[model samples]
Target: AGTVNPLLLFDEIDKLAYDVHGDPAAAMLEVLDSAQNNSFTDHFLELPYDLSQCLLMTTANDADRIPGPLRDRMELIEVPSYLFDEKMEIARRHLLPRQMEKNGLKRTNLRVDDRCLMRLIEGYTREAGVRQLERVLGSVCRKAACEVVEGRQRVQLSLARITEWLGPVKYRQEPAAAEERIGAVTGLAWTPVGGETLEIEVSAMPGKGHLQLTGQLGDVMQESARAALTYVRAHAAALGVEPDCFDKIDVHIHVPEGAVPKDGPSAGIAMMTALASALSGVPVRAGLAMTGEITLRGHVLPIGGLREKLLAAVRAGITTVLLPGKNRDSLHDVPQQVLDALRITFVNEARDVLEHALAQSPVQDGGAVLPDGEAGHAAVCH
Candidate 1:
């Protein structure tokens, strides 16, 4: 069949069957690849057309799932998960007003405090997108509307009321509890929903020094962990680890919050740091954040999202951060106030990060729990 002037959008292209069984993705690839585009419409391996004139937009829940051949043909734009602050602003400017109108309540009658919005974003919802947040707010607005219809003169959304209305808190800020271990590093990650903290826990046990990975990690993160271990072993002296740390120790790396799978190259620095911290018996600095890729020679390679990741640190109440020195240029976009307050150290080598990033100071005896319904976690979206 001959095609029209169609702008094709391959939605959820990643989930399309790509293996064996006739390889639908492989068939679809010819349509996408510029060199082979003419063949898509050709009947007997004939005819050529200007396929470049056609525009294509592809959407996927996870880009990593796309076939490499198909992915290579496209220019990728990443829309990171909304930080709590951004989400609150989104809720305030867009969600709350619309929801209030929908619920037959004026914005004045129902006030969702900025703090309350943050609480909703942090504790109630956990997605890369605001789909759940919107739904939850919609429910709240509907309930408030019902109350107004039943003769309650006013409507209000309070943090305490949120839990009563929404039920038990869905997500906890401290997903991973502190344990007596040196090898675990809390890694901050940007997801489609928002900034999430991941704990990369490493431990040594008796075995032939095997590496075990869990928590449904992806290939890149797994590879990054391997690279981190390699760098740590190679630069043991610089990292303050005995050369044989990996030789005799069977290492197991796990990401806490097992139900929520995590994968990325950005966790490389954290993995390396966790290994170094674990092997050297040094704890990662409390309230310090870091993100970057690592090389085999102990070099700290730059990673993306300097602003999002840094702001993630800030929101976590982190006072210091160790990022790749090469990424220093990206700091110009960061706010000066945040820069001034934070000990943002740039390190070219992964080893140097430990000197400043890992804690020499004692960890605080206990963590402060946010009272019943407070928007805790130092909410910020800069």
Candidate 2:
């Protein structure tokens, strides 16, 4: 089969094995490099093959895991995860018909309405792509086919029947807090699969000033915790925290799901808020989630994965989100319905984040006074 120009897809290239056996990334680089691939040859056959004319495409779950040298040779284009509505349409338009044909069922043999499909998507599957959703659909088709063979002329899947066909719901999203909490804050995190809401909790106990971090955090996140604490200590007076209060207490910070490793600089502001709340007894408002990096001087810096993070916030039932002002422009990538669901506040500094995120000023009985014009939304920064 001598195809002039064939299309080749390399799936999950980032999962290439690394060991003494061979250098997979280096080999991929040679194949992907148009300049070097023209005279490429299969080692088994001593024949030169011109692969330069073939269009090649590669995909990966995590772009950062790709080798630097190999990544430099390819144009990187990020594909965002599908939303619920998109998945529903895709299943109705493509996956369901394909599975129906494969299961030897006529279009009229089984009827699964939109309600049942949505239930399957939300309850039975959780993923960045529709692959799992498609599999679930295929399973539904097979079940219907079995019924048809067992003397049933037609089958209709209702919302109630979906649960019976599939086992119990496999995934459940974390619910947002109903009321304000002390020393607890909601943070947004970006993972290789998708985004998730991270809850950070802090506790202060009487001791000789020691900071403890938990929840299987990685090195960068641990450093972020230190930066947040330093910011809190540096601005103790302004935050209504006694300047020497930290010296007499031991503080511990923890993220939930201790078994899962967590790392990133995006939680800097959330860590700082938790510490300030614990020290000042101020409660952060419920249904408020935030993500952005912070500096020692209390400036809010931009973070990546804005689209995924915002979607996760909405899924968690958060009503408001605090994002770095610099990321304001990145909101265009997010779906408008998601943007409209929440009140998004952009901040350039840590104080603005606190102003928007906290239920009230941290000042206890006016111990520390805030200047005017700092009480409301931060000005939109370019």
Candidate 3:
């Protein structure tokens, strides 16, 4: 620990509790800042220390929880959650064997087939890393050891027995709806744990053109919703919505799982699709999920967490996805299996996405369509 230039890791520094006595994070600025760190003074040492040669690293489940000034000083490298196959391979090659040895059992004493391993990954564990997965494997090893002590020579773990060991599937991924419905669209979202699917629902009622957004959306997401409504209103004539439709009725947009917080620009296209479908009485196409931001001028913009979002869509049995054209090159970062499973369409504007996302083409009802490859709004992700 006293070695020069030792690699120092600050584990979950973001989880530091607020103390009335002092600001630890504020003090960190001096330690991390290279310009000042050469003359750094630690209260513990009460002497000048040079941290300039030391390599420092930190981990956080949610980077947003880290203070802005402190976050700015460090380089952030996002470690994405593993795919199902990756988890399975890791279990077979590393976790399972190590767990067995730790529990005084041999590989031949406990055997788990791919089916059981797959169930363990998809059902028992939910995480961005394999810490929970290792614990689950360790539990299975201990249980197998007990059986061995009972005079059983070998233990063959079956999928049915997995329910007994791990209980029921804890975090099941729900697939998209069976059929298309008006004002309903499936959106992919990135979570603190991993990726998830959100069903955005919209309803129109007779009132004074009011827009209500629900589902614990954050400030940026709420702004995206308002922009979606504005886009729908501005393009009503082109998209076949009555120009006065907004003036005649109040519209409410809600993302299900109301208890969970949902945010980000990734829901922009989905919100616009739901709004367009509600106003035009058209249904969103089934088996399709989308994520991207949209502008009031009807342009599609890139979003963040593309790989995670696409993986979510694939898990949810989505067959098609609409992404911003700017994110097209980012597809290389996604797993090839996920890309092969989905039909991805890249769009530069709203009309292109609506044509692919809606059950029926928006231009069919005596409406015009926006030209392809137009300039769009802000982009921050992917």
Q: How well does each candidate superpose onto the true structure, as a TM-score?
A: 0.73, 0.90, 0.89
| Weakest ten-residue segment in model 1 by summed lDDT | 373-382
**RMSD of candidates 1 onward, in order:** 9.7, 5.6, 6.1
Q: In candidate 2, how many clashes are counted?
A: 0
**Candidate 2 lDDT, 1-382, residue by residue in tens:** 3795898899988888899988878778878999989988766797888889899999999988888888888899999998778888999999999999999999999998888887888788878888988899999999999999998979999877777888878878888999999889999999876788999999888778899999999999999999999998898777656667777778899999999999999999999888877776667898999999999998999999998898889888999999999998898899999899889999888888777767676443423333321321121000
lDDT tens digits by residue: candidate 1, 1-382: 2565578787778888745556877767777887877546544566655565467788887787888888888899876555556677788788878888877787666767777787887778877668888988898888888787888877677878888888878877763333334677767786654565677888766557789999989899999999998876776554444455455667889997788777779888889878766665556666666788888876788887676666667666667678889998988766666677678888787657655656542222221111211111111100
* lDDT to native, each model: 0.71, 0.85, 0.83
lDDT of 3 by residue, 1-382 (tens): 7776988788998987778989888778887888888888889889997888999898999999998988999999988789888888888899999999999998789999998888888888888779899999998888889999999989999987788887888888887788988789999898888888998999888778788989999999999999999988887767556576577788899988899888888899999988877776667888999999988888889888888889889888999999999998888889989999999989888888788877766454434343321111001000
Which candidate number would show the highest lDDT if scored against the true structure?
2
Q: How accurate is candidate 3 locally (lDDT)?
A: 0.83
Task: Report model 2's TM-score to 2 decimal places.
Answer: 0.90
Q: Candidate 3: how many backbone clashes? A: 2
